[model samples]
Target: MKTNLYSSIIEKISSDKFSSIFILVDENTEQFCLKLFIKKTGIKSFNKIIIDSGEENKNIDTCVSIWDQLNSFKADRKSLLINLGGGVLTDIGGFAASTYLRGIKFINIPTTLLGMVDAAHGGKTGIDFKLLKNQIGVFNDPLEVLLDNDYLKTLSKEEFINGYAEVVKHSLLTDKPDLTFNSLVKLDLFNDSEYIINSYSLVKNEIVKSDKYESSIRKVLNLGHTIGHAVESYSHISDEIIDLKHGQAIVIGIINELYISHKKFNFPLRDVVSVKKHLKKYFTLIPLKENDMENIYDLMVYDKKNEGSKINFVLLKEIGKPVIDQIVDKELFKESFVFYNE
Candidate 1:
């Protein structure tokens, strides 16, 4: 366990006399990071609740199971929950804790890059509804956050790269002007502990500063998620499925929207080429079928961020500039996919 993560949680939990400690884990995280969590947090004899880990299991049933566990344990308002796992566990657990007993103090111990940089930091907690992503959730801040780089070793290669997408997005939006594509690509991102921790802190601080409630500046965080989630949902339902991690799907969304941005904003060609070149190497372009396109467009319309009939997208003005709420023409959204146009 890293000292920073241990100290961070202690700072919050030590301030109160709690009923008991409760920690949440999914199947994978329990196998990978449980020992370290116990060693560091030292919450011996804490109640442990485990769920099946995947996008498919993030639903009402899982939430109900968690609520039942808390009820059986006699968990009270002062009881603290340490969410120990990836984004799915953190989101579901946070949602359960918030609704349980009208919310309780919880700390996040994220074990994946996707969880650490994005899900673990922000207070956004929820599960998907009828294949839509994060449909029901609460805006509750965690009492503390713990990011230990050691957990990265447990993530699969795809999962590791899945998270890199957000880090890349952060650099594109917030970093110094000198932040270039090549420099980010060449970054020893996973190997160095300091780099990973710094990146987590950087994204966390940026979101916390801008839209702690996810109403304004935090909308930038959804740059690729709007379409990305639609893509994930499409894959989950369709017959000719395309399996895509959230980051990979978001990368595709970035590509499709890049075309839109190029047309609407006259975004620089060189920057577009740079982004495509870096991401294309990792994620192959998946063809979207006609039915897939229609379903995706429908899902995108229901996005929580949409204000009216027009769907709002966050697009780039340049490499380091992000512009939001650029109303996307519905037709363009459909035609942008090669399979749909064909």
Candidate 2:
């Protein structure tokens, strides 16, 4: 399906003429995106389903609630669900829509930068199970994905930075030298929204088209996610009141994984330093205690990409070159954190 196209989304929805429409949003998007969507698109009749915002809410329980709402509203197969929010809202809403009545038409209106660049385009729809990220999901593409940069203006600096992490990942994966950290920092999402979003979407779409099921080349997209998901889950499960946002945790993952690349693949240390320096501008290091490392490692073992006891990683051989399914020793995994600390 075509992505990041605003006009096409409106055209498609108008043409579909569905029996009913439903909009799923969190508390955040209800305030920001839904209003603008209503005003701009002149779509006034959809039922509104607002959930609480945050990673904690992306779960089976939330899906059940959304399902109950759809049932109560008597939404049919012809109904269209428009998911409007950040990653959390899109993930859960997509899962809910895909499952309801054996599947209903759905669209994604990504309100956050992260959602626009990463979560909205991918056909992967999922919710976290037992605090592991995307443990339960289906490969279901939305009928259309609408990206409007105006929604990004409502995001706080931290939320914007969270999305920027995925952009950095996209840059690292592609051969785009112009998409460097320095250039990204100066980018005005409002003015350059089409170029940036479409560029990232093109990279992801090309990769996904090759490995739709993530068996081989697609695993390269999981570059920072192995350790990143663990760190994110650890924060959620830990007693710490402050949870790490997905992009914040990912930046940490990117740094330590780059260190692992340096140790295992002899990737250039200078490049690692350059990446770390650029990332540190947006995120502070999350100090991992020995116990935290133990917990995080435990979480990594449950990664969906693993086979039996072996923990597979996608480490970079060089900038823009990712080697997937590399198994790192446990001791080196532990030592990588030490390198990150330094």
Candidate 3:
């Protein structure tokens, strides 16, 4: 476990001084990463709540189920809930804990790379609605986060690669950008637990600077997600499954929208091509059908960031300099997909 995770969690717990501790885990976390908790902390007597895992299980019903479980445990504001799993567990569990008794202290012990780097750091909590991703959620920070790279050993290649996308994106947008998309796409570091954990923590600390609230600087984190989430939602409905991992979907989204940046914002085309080459090595270019584009485009309109019909995308003027609020043209949006498929 990284020192930052323990320190962050302890700082919050000490500040809050909750009366009871409630830890949340799904079936998978219990199997893979439970012992880490036992070794690190003296918290042997915490209330445990288990829920189903996976994207499909992320819903209001799941939140309700957690709420009911919290009630059963007689959880109060003085109690702290520690979400100990992947994004699904944290998102849904955080929401349950937050809503219960009008918000309680919650900590995130993210086991998956996805959770540690991206999902765990952010205070955003919610579940999907109507097959839409994170359609219902709130922006609230956890008391602290616990990140252990050892947990990633159980991840499949696809899952590891999926989580790697965010790391690549973070690198691309940051000053050092030391971790190239090529190295990550290779997925060779799957065995290097320390490297995996440190990489995620570096990115987390970068994006989660003083702007932990996500009002200004943090919106840059949505660089790929604005379009990726929409594409992922459409893929979920397709019969073929689209074979798109979360990272793969974001890679495509970034590429397609990078094209938008190139044309609209005059972003460098060479940088985009370099990134595409690196990403395409790991992610097969999925051909979006005409209807797939339409459905995904429609979904983008419903994005929470939108103030009106215009979709605001965080586009890069260059590789590291990202600018937001540039409303993407729908016709041009369609054309970018064409370029992507080509």
- Who wins the lDDT comparison? 2
What TM-score against the true fold does each predicted structure earn? Answer: 0.92, 0.93, 0.89
User: Which tens-of-lDDT digit does each residue in 1-342 have in candidate 2?
Assistant: 323345665665676678888989888889887888887777757798888898888999899999999999999999989999988898999999999999998998898889889998868999999777899999999987776777888889778878877887887787667764445656775577667887777778788989988889999889898999888988888985258999988988888898999999998989889888888877888778788888889999998878998899989888788899999888988998987777
CA RMSD of each candidate after superposition: 2.5, 2.6, 2.9
lDDT of 3: 0.78
Model 3 Cα lDDT, one tens digit per residue, 215-329: 7777778888888988887788878555465777898789888889899889888878887887777678788877888888999998877778888888888767788777887
TM-score of 1: 0.92
> Which regions of candidate 2 fall more than 4 Å away from where they truly are?
1-6, 180-194
**Sort by TM-score, top down from the best:** 2, 1, 3
> What does candidate 1's lDDT look like per residue over 73-128, in tens digits?
99999898889998888899899999998998888888888788778877889999
Q: Give the Cα error of residue 29 in candidate 3, in Å.
A: 1.0
| Model with the higher lDDT, candidate 1 or 2 | 2
List candidate 1 segments past 4 Å from native.
10-16, 178-182, 338-342
Instruction: Give the whole-model CA lDDT for all candidates, comma-separated.
Output: 0.77, 0.84, 0.78
